[model samples]
Target: MNRRETRDAVVHFGPDADWVREAAAESSAVAAADGVASYDEPEADAGAADAAGARLAVCELSPDAGVEALAAVRDALPTVPVLAVVADADAVDDALAAGAADVLVRRDGVDDTALLARRMEGVAATPAESRLGAESTAQLLDAIDDSFYALDADGAIRRWNDSFSRLTGYEDEELAGMDALELFAGADRERIAGAIETVVETGSATAKAELVARDGETTPVEFTGALVTDADGSPSGIVGIGRSLTERREREARLARLRQAVETIVDRAPLTLFEVEADGTVSTVRGETLPERLGRRVSEGDAAEGVFADQPEMRRHVAAALDGEPAHGLVEVGDSTLEAWLQPALDETGRVTRAVGLALDVTEREERAVMLDQIQASAGEVIWISTPGKESMDFVSDAYEDVWGRAPETLRSDPMSFVEAIHPDDRERVEAALTEQREDPDAYEETYRVVRPDGEVRWVHDQSSGVYEDGELTRIVGIATDITVRRRRERELRLKNRAVETAPVGVAIHETAESAGPITYVNEAFASVTGYDGDAVAGEGLSALAGDDTDSDRLHAVASAVKTGDRGSATLVLYRADGTPFWGRVDVAPVVDGDGEATHAVSFVQDVTESKEHEQEIERHLTEFGEVLAEDLGVPLREARDRLDAATDDDPDADLRRAEESVERAVSLVEDLATVHSFSVEPRRLSESMRGSSPAPAGRDE
Candidate 1:
C-alpha cells in the first residue's frame, strides 16, 4: 500500500507517561513500516483522519484515574475503536469497564504499536453493515430483566442494559458508557479486577460483590460473567449478567435473626440444643458448656471411639432425627439427665438436610420423680401414665409393683403387660372406660378386677384424666384404689338379705311411733288366719285387719298400756283376704334398744277363729244335753237324791258317787264353754314371750 492508502491509528498517553512514550515510539515505527501514520496526541477536528476514514484510539490509563477517565475519553470520540494498555493486571478491569477495544499488560517481547496498528487495519477493513449489526445486538440485550453488560478484552464496560440503570440508580445518559470498576464499591474494586482477569483466562467467573449505586448506596449482587469468543475460540470480550440479591439477602438476614433469637431462648433454658449434619456430624448449638464439650464437627473416628462418652444416647437420637423422625423425652446422659426434643431440618426442596435438637436438664425433675416413686411404692394405690396409641407406659408410679404383685420396671417396659393382668371379664369394661375417658375427659371412675402375680384377684377402682396438648390427647394419668374388701362385704350383705326375704313366716318387727298405736307383729298363724300373705300386710298396723264391729276404745286401751312399759292383750275380729271376719288375740309388748328406751312394739297375733267356733258348738251341745238331763231328772230333787242315795248306799254307794260325778262333769263342761266364749270377746293376759319375731312367708297355715 502507498502512503495515501495506508491505515492510520491514534495513540493517547494517560497517567503512565513512561509506558505511553515507549508504546508511542514503537507504534510510530510500525506505522512507518506499514506506510501508515499514528499520533500520540488528540486528532485534529474533521480533516485529519479522512486518509484512513477510521481511527483506533489507544489510551494509556493511570491506575489512579481508573475506568472513569477512560470513559470520558471514549465519550469525547464516540466513533473510534479504543484499545487500553495497562502496566499491571490490577488495571485490566478498569480498562475493560471503560470500554477498551483491547488490553496489553506490560511484558517483554510484545510489540505494542504493531499489535494496535494491525488490529486497527482489521477494524478499518470491516463493512459498515457489520458494525451496525453489532450495535443492534447490544440494543436488544438492553431490554432484558437482568443487568447485562459486556467487557472488552481490556476489561471495560463496552455495553450495558437499561436494567443496569434501574439496579444502580443511574440513568442511561449518566452511566451508559461508564466503567465496570466504577460500579463496584471502593473496597471491591481490586477484587473485581482480579475476577475480571480470572474470567478472561478461564472463560467464566461467578462471585458475590457489593456495588455502589448512583445514589451512593451499596447493594449486594451476584455477578456471573463469561468470556465472549470469536470464530476461532479466542477471547474477544466478556459478557456479564448481574442479579440484585438485596431481597434474598434481607430474607437471609431475617432468618439469621430468628435463629439467633431461638438460640438465645434455648440456651437460657435448662436444655441443650444440637444440629446434626446429614453425614452424622453432631454440633451442640446451645445449653450449658456443650459448645466446649462437642466441637464444631464430630468426626467418624471420634464417634466410633465413643466421642460422646458422656452421652451415648445422643448418637441414637441423631440417627433417629436423620431418619426424619423426632426422638424425645428423658434420656440418660452420663451421670446427669436430659429431656430432649428432636426434629429434622429440611432444604428448599423439603428434603431432610440435617437434624436439630433441644435438650432440657431434667435432673432435678428426675430426682423429684424418684422421691415420688418411693412414696407411691409405699402407698396402697397404683398410679400410672399411658401414652397415646396405648402402645406403652410412659411412666408408672412404684405402687404398681406392690398392688399388682409385679415389678414396676416390668410394667413400665410394657403397659399392655399390666392390661393383660386384668381379668378377662373386666378387660372389656376397663378398655371401654379408658376409651370413653379419652373421648370425653369427664368420663372417669371405672371399676374392674385384676389378677395379681400370685393369682389372687382383687377389685380395683380406677379414676383417670387425659392429658391434652395442642388439642390432642397425649397421655393419661390414673389412680387405682383396691376395693376388694368392700366388694366382699357387699356380697355377704346381699346373701343375708336374700335369706331374710325368703323366710317362711308372716313375722314382722314393727317400729313404734309415739302418736300411732301398737303395730301388728303377725306370725305364720296370723297369715293363715287372714288367708293373706305376710308381705301383703307387713307395714299395716294392728287396726288394719280389725273388723268394723271391733271396739276402738278397747284397742286404744291395750296400746296405751303397752306403750307405758306394760304388756297388754286384746281379742278382735280381723278381716281375711276374702273379707271374712275372724277372731284374733293380739299380745303387745315393748321392744327396747341398748339405751333402755322403747324402740318398737312387738305383737303376737293368733288366729282364734276356729277355736271360738268349736267352743260355740260345744256350748250348743252342752245346752241341749243339760236340758235333757233336767227333764230326765224331773222328779223332786230330794227324792232323786234320796233314791240315788238309797240306791248308792244299798249298792255300795259306787253308783251314787258315779252319777254325781257325771252330773258335776256336765255342769263343768257348760261353764268352760261359756268361759271360752267370754275370753274370745274380752282382753286376755299378755306376756313378752308371745311376741312374734318378724313377718311370715306367703300362704302359711295358722
Candidate 2:
C-alpha cells in the first residue's frame, strides 16, 4: 500500500496556528515518513501559503460569523480547497453555508490530526473541473453533474453546457431560442418561472423544481441563479445551475419513514436505542426502561462489557453485531420484556465496526396479549381492532366466536360480516349509527340483539373508541359483550315489580335485615291498608304501628325476628295515621344472598280487623254464658252430692246403689259445663305456644 506519496503542504491559517501545526505535524510526520499527501509550510515570516499552489487551505473562522475572513481567504487562494474550522458544532453549518468547501469543529477534529488530515486530503482530491476557480468556466460547467444554462431576461436560453443538453435532450441548434421556463412543466414550470423572474428582479434566487426533457420525463432539480448584467447595469440574462435533487429527496423520504416508525415505537412503548463500538463500548444510550447497574442512568462511552456483566445473552447479541451478523428477539429486562433488534453497521471496507441496538419495552403489549388469550378462554366479550377510519379489521379476538357466533377468521376477512349476525330488526339501525360515527369516532356505545347461527337471540352491548394522534384517527378498538343473561334478569325484575304493585296484599320491601334498614319500597296496597302514605311512613318500622291495645309482647317478637332475617307472622292491634286501631296480620320472609346470609326481608301485610273483632265478640258471649251457668247450677250440684251421701248404705240393697250412681252422673255434667266456658284462649297466647314459648319466645325478642 503506497501510503507515502509526496504532494503539497496543507496551509494552516487561524488564531491558533500552533494548534493546527501540532495536528498537522502528526499527519505531516506520518505522510513524510511514508511520502504520501504532504503540505510544506511557507516561511515563518510569510504567515501565508504559496497562494497559487497550496493543496488545501485550513482557515480558522470567527465563531460568530466567519463570513468576512472566509471571503478574504477564498479571494486570495481562489482555487485552493478551503476547510473552515469553527469553535462549536453549530458554527460548522454556518461556515459551510457561507461557501466553505468543508467544515470541522475545533473540539471534534483538533485532537484527531490524522482524521483532520484525511478530510483535507479528501477535499483536495476533488477534480479541478469540480472546484472553484477552475482554469476555464466552460470546462467547469461541462464537468458539473448539474445542468448549467444562461438565459436572457425574457427567459430565452442563450448559452448551455453538455449537462444541460443531456438533461433537456436538446442540441445547441434546437435550444437556440427556447424559453428557459419551457424546460419545465406542471407546477414545477410555474415555480421555476417565478424563480427566474425573481432572479431577473432581485439579482439572485434559489428554487426547487422538476426539469422536463424532450421525452416527457422530468428530473427534480434545485435551480440557483444569479442575474448577469451588461456594462450599464441593465439585466442581460441569468446564469444558474440546476442541481438534480432526486437522490437527496429520495434519501430524505427514506430517513423520514424510518424516523416515523422509531418515534412511534418510542412514544407508545418504553424503549432504549443504543450504539456499541466493535470493542464493546457503548457510544450512545437514549430512550427508556433499559436496566442499568444499581439503577444508574446509562451514559455514553460506558464499556458494554461492564454494564451488561450479568447478561450473557445481551453480550452475545453485541458480539454478533460486531461479527457482522444481526440479532433480534424478546429479552426480559427486570420486570419488563423488551423486543430487541441488533443490527450491524459497517464502514466502506464492509468490516463490521459498530452495532446499533433497539430495545423496545413491549411489557404492556405482551401482558395485554396474554390477557386477550385468557379472555378468549373464559370472557364473554369479543375484542376487535380496526385500521384507521375503520376501513378494515386488523385483528379480531377468538372471543368473537362466543359473542358474535362467527369465526374470528371470518370477521377478519370481511369486517362487515358482524352485521350479518345482528338481528334483522337492528341491523339497519346499527349500520346507520356506525356510518354517522365515522365523522366523530370517540366513545361510541350501542346495545342491540344478535341472532346466532342456532337462531338464539343474544343481547349485545357494544362499545368502541378511536385512538387518535395529532387529531388524526390511527386505530379503532371495540368490545362487544354478551349481555343476554343480564337483559333477562332486568326483564324479570320489571315484571315482578309490576306484579308486586298490582297485588291485593300490602307489600313492604326492606333493603337490609341483619343491618336493620328502613323499608326501601312498598306497594300501593300498603298505603291504602295502613292509612299511612309512603311519605308519612318513612323510616317507621312495623313495631312503630303498635297501638295501646296492641299485644306489645307479640309485636316485639315479630319485629325482632324480621330484623334478624327470620320469618314470622302475627295479627296485632296496630294504629293507622288517623289514630284508628286495626288488626293487621303481617307475614315476613327473609331474602338471603348466594352465601345464605340474609340481606333483606319482604313482608305481606293484610288487614284482619273484621275477623279479629268477630272473634273477640264470640269469646265475650262464651264468657257471659259460663258465668250465668255457674250462678244457676252451683247450689244444686252441692245439694245433690249431700243427698247421694245420705242415701248410700255401705253394703245396702240394689236400690240404694242405683240412686248413688244417678247423683254422681248429674254432678259430673255440671262440672263439665263449668270448664267448657273457661276454654276461650287469646290468639296472642296461641301464637306464643306455636313458637314453643308462652312469653313471645324471649331473648332480644324485640
- Please name the candidate that would achieve the greatest lDDT relative to the true structure: 2
Compute the lDDT of residue 33 as modeled in candidate 1.
33
lDDT of 2 by residue, 1-702 (tens): 111233445655555655555555555322232222223321121224354445677777654323445555565567776788777664443344334678877674336666666676677677765665534546656776767787887889987778889988888899998988788877888898888888776666789887888998888888777666543446777766777888899999999998888777765656678888888888545565344421457666778887676667788888888899999887666776777789999899998889999877678999998987787677668888887556689988787887677788887778888888899899888888788667655657889999989898999998888888898878888888889999999999999989999999998877663345467777899988877767776666776577777898888777776788888888787777766666789898988999999888888889875566457657667766766767677677678767667766445668767777776786676667677666655554443332341123134352
- Give the Cα lDDT of each candidate: 0.63, 0.71
Clashing pairs in 2: 4-34, 4-35, 4-36, 5-35, 5-36, 8-38, 8-39, 9-39, 9-40, 10-39
Which 10 successive residues of model 1 have the least lDDT summed? 685-694
Please report the candidate that would top TM-score against the real structure: 2
